[model samples]
Target chain A: MQGTTRTPSQPTTAYQPTDRTVPTRSPDRASYDKELVHSILDEGYVCHLGFVRDGAPVVLPTLYARVGDRLYVHGSTGSRPLRMTGAADPGLPVCLTVTHVDALVLARSAFHHSINYRSVVVHGSAYDVTDPQEKRTALDALVDHVVPGRSGDSRPADKKELAATAVIRLDLDEVSAKLRTGGVNDEPEDLALPHWAGLLPLRKGYEAPIADPGLAPGTGLPGYLSAL
Target chain B: MQGTTRTPSQPTTAYQPTDRTVPTRSPDRASYDKELVHSILDEGYVCHLGFVRDGAPVVLPTLYARVGDRLYVHGSTGSRPLRMTGAADPGLPVCLTVTHVDALVLARSAFHHSINYRSVVVHGSAYDVTDPQEKRTALDALVDHVVPGRSGDSRPADKKELAATAVIRLDLDEVSAKLRTGGVNDEPEDLALPHWAGLLPLRKGYEAPIADPGLAPGTGLPGYLSAL
Candidate 1:
């Protein structure tokens, strides 16, 4: 429920096309539907954050959260990207991407082998969040993003902890989702070959909740986690 | 068996640490071990590749394979990154990263919540691979990387298929693996809190393979896939 609020100024269904969001190849696989982009972004646990450092590109994997039309990424105040955004006057340009591999498509020919995946890419300028209220909301969204309703269950961050953390915000203006689904596309001539061709679906989910050893004796498992 | 050969010039046990490979925040979590890096890279199906374009960073998810201390990424010849690398005189500077989320670490306090994960980041220049022999080997490695021993079972690429694919190579000279493992690390004072804190382990693996409907009747599932 954190990222469900919409403003009148925002696009109703699909995002507007931008130069960077358009793919140079396989344009058919790209989509600007707002629902598709949000679903892909929400399903991911971490995002690969790209930024320029010393004139060279650097990519790092970190936690992220989406709220309405904005995305939030956090780290220690001393982290490189956070520090860079704080020092820059306007903002730090960044590319944030999230991907989910659903299955492996094995074809009769090596050339046709591919993976079925869903991915979302957002290009924008990241600015450090200084407002105390927005920062707190972002932090709660980040925690809840990992596990729904987790923020209310856990102890909120104290003043000292809040000061040590840095949160950056990126508006989801230039965004697009690319996806590939379904079966293998082997050549017709190679259909009768000895190779066994098919789809190997990748399964991912939570196993069981492991309780902390130091947990209080009477603590019970939360309903939100049990439902997952 | 592909990508296992090592040259005499390569390091024995670990990779050399470069300035860009070091993490500015959690230095203790960074590693340069060669085996650790290879194991992490081999387990992933997709990588987030980052490159600078027009002074801004771009990140895309793509399939990749590792040969010895080198990584190969393939795409259509008309792809933006592939075209850019072919045009750049000294090759294109890129950051390739792979990550696996092992578990969700839930702490009694929101500040200590984190994920247990293993990730590898490689910083270097990516050059177009024009040599036919090397490109073929890289393509095989790419297939086998998805499923072990799969390259031999599939039909080899023909001349037309090879002409359509573009391959690029990046040496793993500047590489580092960062990992976060073990249980939650909540504040000692919060140990007595009522919240249930622990790790929610994520399970990922291949399910039963679904055969292609057009497959020859007698074709059986390969032993390598059965083993998985």
Candidate 2:
């Protein structure tokens, strides 16, 4: 979206799509705008992490948080994938993708059936966050990512818990956001068909919060939970 | 979960986990239960399909449906990934995963912050459905998967439309369902912290469907939309 005249040392608002980030399908829907990619990533709570395992592809759904240009994901200390990511100096090549389905497009022609979705795909090598401070920040960002202000209200990770968790960081460079929006686009002839063609919107919403049964007698729902 | 005493030719209620389906982390949460796997797949509207391209794993989010033991996904015939899936004779090795986040598990310690989620992972090869009748059935199943009774209400696909779309069917052989439910599992010492630790449930619900502005005057809202 912008000129590549800026050196790698300088910070830029736009992402430069590489060969891997470029989409061969619906190319028109792909964008390298950093804001768009960040918005999609922020709206999503979980990401599908794809990596080559024993010559076969494996995808796992896990919680993720985007802080600045870096994406952070944490796992158990005993997790093989996380351990493998930090085993090598260059780290593990990974594809992290987050998607949000806005609506279901019911076109007149069945072939045109599609979903209104916003997705961000990041291609990079994931490195383990060995620094304790960075690890704590990443973990806090992850909790705050799910619900704003909740991190401040929640207790910070202790030494024992921090020692048990492993955090991996992926700096977003080859990033692209693909989005399909609006109503259905039916064929000229199919427009006159009797079938109803439009969008059936989908939304993920927060419901009433349930407090732990072991809560102190006087403890009440936090203000942030009420707002959510 | 049931014993796998039935023959391959006969239907079985339980799924047998191989080396691939077993989880390296949180192995206790993983199950080889067919009913649980099906339930997780059925509840999700989108799935992340991972495949290898240029020796790198790429994950794409797309619509999918589960019928019997077969999972069906369709895309544009011109799509590069979809095209490569059918270009090979034996089909393409894929890891299809569906996840549903039931609640946000907030623990007193940030490291224990996790999600109550149900996810199903199916590892197998996907083959293109060539038969016209089978393709139609698969397409219908995909449509109904989004909204029950939708395929019956909507017009079926025509010959030309079917020709333009490529349907890939993946048989569910190596399937595993992983789920984390209930409240936060915080450390006993951390329970005394001032932070509020509980669950924030998330729900996906349908709003009142809006009719197309270009709809015929007498055309009314579908009954299915009302139920939704």
Candidate 3:
């Protein structure tokens, strides 16, 4: 929300629905609107990256950044997923998901208890970013994704550092955003019950930033972080 | 941490590591300690469930409850994953992960920027909970997992509700907890840079609970919620 800029022209564009993107349950909660999908993806810092390993599913939490319709994830060159996406190999299939839990829905009945959340799921093949120019931009996006204006404040990665890191790009082609908002969904019969029921909103934000012990004297908090 | 009780006798026990649980990177951050794994899992409200579908991996965020060595996930009987775990089908292989971002680690160099996080990855086979007694207990755990002491105050699910819900159990056989904590890890050459570098801690907690508009008159906020 802070560092990323949205394309105004694509506000009304929607992704074409595919069989895998359509959910079997709660189909009403799913949306293919591009703007809605981007908002959900940009607000989160980490994504659960799912890939098949040894014929079994493996999900790992990793840092990701969205640039236009493409998502980039970087790691050490030797990392399993990064290694699997080599230049010679075909793209690796991955399912990337980001979720934000907004509130805990407390209902009068145990069966009705639920969480209000927004999530986006993307199914695509990830390929290595070999172009130097694109790789550098993706790396900057990754840093700013965590904290806006951070890439400019920090030293850019040198050739050696860039060589050691691997970036994988996944296009946001087959995706869907799912959300559950609003109040409790308690049964009519249970409304009169004595239990207190409503939404317990979860708040997430930054506290006071701890300055590094070795930070240069007189260095001040950047405007972006202070705004946060 | 609030409602779930730890087994005192297993304080020093560690889960036997398997090939899948061992990470290919950051080996030092991975721990097979049972207590550490349970703590990471219990503190989170949702898990990213990864399962293979049509030979491709799919990851979804869903509510989960941990009971001793078992984790239970419930959904509508017709949900995709739930339907896949029918009585006659072989157990579904799943990789369940829970992650908590503790801080945003800002470094002097963009390449070193990282986040302080704790995560647990569990690899196992999930089977439908066919036994009525286990299903009931699992359902209560699911409710209590959201709010401690909530299951007791709320109305238990009736026969029809239980019939509509599907609960699946995954044994905590192959599990590992990975953590990244503490301060910035800036390179020595960049320590003298002017950028502010350190940890921006992320705070997560509930704000005041919003009482349901139709709450019964004179109903008070429950003790369990007040404690939270």
Model 2 Cα lDDT, one tens digit per residue, A46-159: 999999888888999999999999999998888877988878698898889999988887766666677788999998889999998899889889989988887887777777
Q: After superposition, how far is residue B82 of candidate 1 from its true place, in Å?
A: 0.6
lDDT value, candidate 3, whole model: 0.90
- Cα lDDT tens digits, model 3, B103-142, are 9999999988999899999998899999999999999999
Q: Which is the leading candidate under lDDT?
A: 1
DockQ of each: 0.81, 0.60, 0.83
- lDDT, residue A219, model 1: 95
Q: Write the per-residue lDDT of candidate 2 for residues B52-112, one digit (tens) a residue.
A: 8888889999999988999999988987668988898988989999988888987777777
In the range A157-222, model 1's lDDT, one tens digit per residue, is 999999999999999999988888878887778988989999999988998989988899999999
Q: How displaced is residue A25 in candidate 3, in Å? A: 1.0
B1-228, model 1: which lDDT tens digit per residue?
A: 112222323466788888889888877778888988999999999999999999999999999999999999999999999999989889999999999999999999999999989999999999999999999999999999999899999999899989999999999999999888888888789999999999999988987899889988799998999999
Residue pairs that clash (backbone atoms under 3 angstroms), model 2: none
**Worst 10-residue stretch by lDDT in candidate 2 chain A?**
A1-10
